[model samples]
Target: MTKKHVHSVTVSTLSDPLPSVAAKTKKTHSVWREYVKSRYLFVMLLPVIIWYAIFAYGPIYGIQLAFKEFHILDGINGSPWVGMENFKYLFFQSPDFWLVMKNTVLLSLYHIVFGFPAPIILAILFNEIRYDLFKRIAQALTYLPHFLSWVVLSGIMFIILSPTTGVVNYVMAAFGLEPIYFLGDQNYFRFTLVISAIWKEIGWGTIIYLAALVSIDTQLYEAAIMDGANRWKQTLHITLPCLLPTIAIMFIFRVGGILDAGFDQVLNLYTPGVFSVGDIIDTFVYRMGISQMQFSLTTAMGLFKNVIAFALVLLTNYLVKRSGQEGLI
Candidate 1:
């Protein structure tokens, strides 16, 4: 080829890619420009990001303490590794292990059996109510308990359940029955915990079911009515079927948290007398780690709870999916 022709070919080769290259460059610039335009939105999100970074994720480093024989003097970094010693201690060596585990599991089961369904019933009743004003008042009354912290709620419980001048006791006395110390008695403590938990959380839980109810097609109810179905039949055939997915998702989450068993509520309400029936894994961990200073052992307990919770979540989700419903996996 002639030199001029060769130069012309080189020029064409360089120019040929310019359109595509320039398009890519412009696309990249547009992305950054869009990001810059929406920077204030990100700035608004910065606090949440930082909050999670600090509170939620920052403590992840301490997970290593579960495997290490943590020492106050040696610190987390210098602590000697102990493999599964902490876990072995938690499972076999600790005196409170089985007791606390049983309490945790039983309490969770109680809550699932009674507490889980309480809100569903309440939501249904609320939905069935014809008077909007009465419904609103009832909803507000129920929702009020959820806003109270467990500490405050527990204090109120102590006052109400006290054997001396409590309103419950007063009613019992008027009925010619003995005043009972509900919180102090082991027989009553677990039941009280479950009941209180239901009372506190049922309102909040009802909110979710109410939202799900709103999404149900009104025509389904109309169709059920046209088919000569009663309220009960409609609930069974239409309302429940429509709500199955939401209920399944919530049930999965509830099962995942079985190990939790209301740490704050149990801690605040329970005394040494009720420890046999009321002391759960979280409370046991608190006593061991905070009160008694068994850092590694308590960390192991927490780690164990987390692992079981994670596994339960996965298993429940799998079962839900197998049942032909949407799951939270």
Candidate 2:
């Protein structure tokens, strides 16, 4: 009887592993079957995959150039490594480092303070609008500027802000005031940048919140109304609470880009006079890497910016999560 019991225990031990093995095999089969069935979806995504592979992941090979003294004759592979010299030069050696960092952070902070709320306010207003036709027209107009390239926008702005023959100057003349050089004046330039950025992207940004607003349960608003709540009360209590998760996620993303003041906008609009207020990490990198051919320095700067951006994103996500909100980690 003891021998029979031992044999049964042995049988049970062997059979336990059999079910696990079968389960793993079944999971693998299911995964492969799904992949086969959705091959067309993957086919549709081929261009995006190929684009990122070539343009994004493919460039990862050159990242080592940041640590090396790259020469045209020596080439990337033949370049001699300098370790952290390039990074040290970029951060400590360059006199423009602190000034450029200040400009970048200030502009980004301005955008966060003013530009971030513009879209939310616009979205809220649009949601409250009773006139569908006016809402559609206003949305279309706001969205138009975003499609225009910064180069084109800069030209339009130059014409509009011209001290001599601009409509803005004409308005100032009518008001018996001096015609201000909006683009060239250091005092007004940053304000122009912030306002233009807000105007350009406000509509596109609103689309997200508008979608969020749509997803809100109408029954909640109905109950609020039944309980003597006005539109303001309903929006404050119900709409805002429901939108918090989306707002938290978007805010985290914005915080991640705190160092990326609008590169294209500043590049097109800025001159030597405005460089103090306008030059940012991206523009700095462009001048160093493209114009001066300081490959290692520019690459190091790029890496530094990315590292800070990543760290900010992680920190912001952690904070948001701790506040019991969904974060875009």
Candidate 3:
């Protein structure tokens, strides 16, 4: 009986998994255990996960429409394949496509050049303000515009910028200058769009920088002051260096969305007269997709814009890292 029991025990030991397999199984068990312990946290995150799944990722499936000759009656899956014909027309065949692409790229560049730095400057100014009450008031006033929709703000802008009786024209008349048709004239439309976009978003954009400012060590500033550094010198040295990582990350995100040149603002502010200069990818897509029902064409345009934007983000991140700054990656 003892010999039989020893033989059975040896057979069970030989049936056990090898060392590598056992190690993998143990690691997986540890991960599952940690996940079980954090189950409540996952439950808390479930809503956000659901929201993204429903609204963000769910729409991704329709991207195939870009490669199809979509027919409403035939549905997305049933639509006939068109290969690269949509992209071919977008790049070579269509007349307005190149013009729209040019406008989109130029407008995006304008925003990056002018609008990107406005919030950082404003946040620094806000940090320097000594009077708490006055700073709060200033912030509130600037932030109020961000809460208003472009549709509402555009009406306010029309009243203020009217060439005949508007406040802007009235001031110009007082200064012995001619009234400029800011919205109507193609020459001024793009600038107006850029300026208005900066004004509306600058306050909100400062929120992130201001939060980052709070995380900075006060000791750094004290040390700078002890070394006879002035405000400008301290900002140039300590403040900016500390904020560099945040700035690099934010810049990467901004570059990622470079194609999105304020659709709402442009849509509300532009007219037929300014379309040549003010028209952008989003507005063009809106007209083609919704108004004209050229779904396949517009989808191709969207796919193209998104691909370029994604490439820009990757390139920008690489450049930032190469410059010895932290990147979003």
Clashing pairs in 1: none
Alpha carbon lDDT at 171, candidate 2:
93
The segments of candidate 3 whose C-alpha lies over 4 angstroms from its true place after superposition are 1-41
Q: lDDT tens string, model 2, 11-65?
A: 9998999999999999999999999999999999999999999999999898999
Candidate 1 weakest lDDT stretch, 10 residues: 87-96
TM-score of each: 0.91, 0.94, 0.89
Per-residue accuracy of model 1 over 225-320 as CA lDDT, tens digit each: 999999999999998899899999999999999998999999999998989999999998898889989999988888899999999999999999
Q: Residue 232, candidate 3: how far off, in angstroms?
A: 1.2
RMSD for each model, in Å, please? 3.8, 1.8, 4.3
Among these predictions, the greatest lDDT belongs to 1
Off-target runs (Cα >4 Å) in candidate 1 are 1-33
**Residue 91's lDDT in candidate 2:** 75
* Location of the lowest summed lDDT over 10 successive residues in candidate 2: 90-99
TM-score of candidate 2 on Cα atoms, chains taken together? 0.94
* Candidate 1 residue 82 C-alpha distance from true site, Å: 1.3
Q: What is the descending TM-score order? A: 2, 1, 3
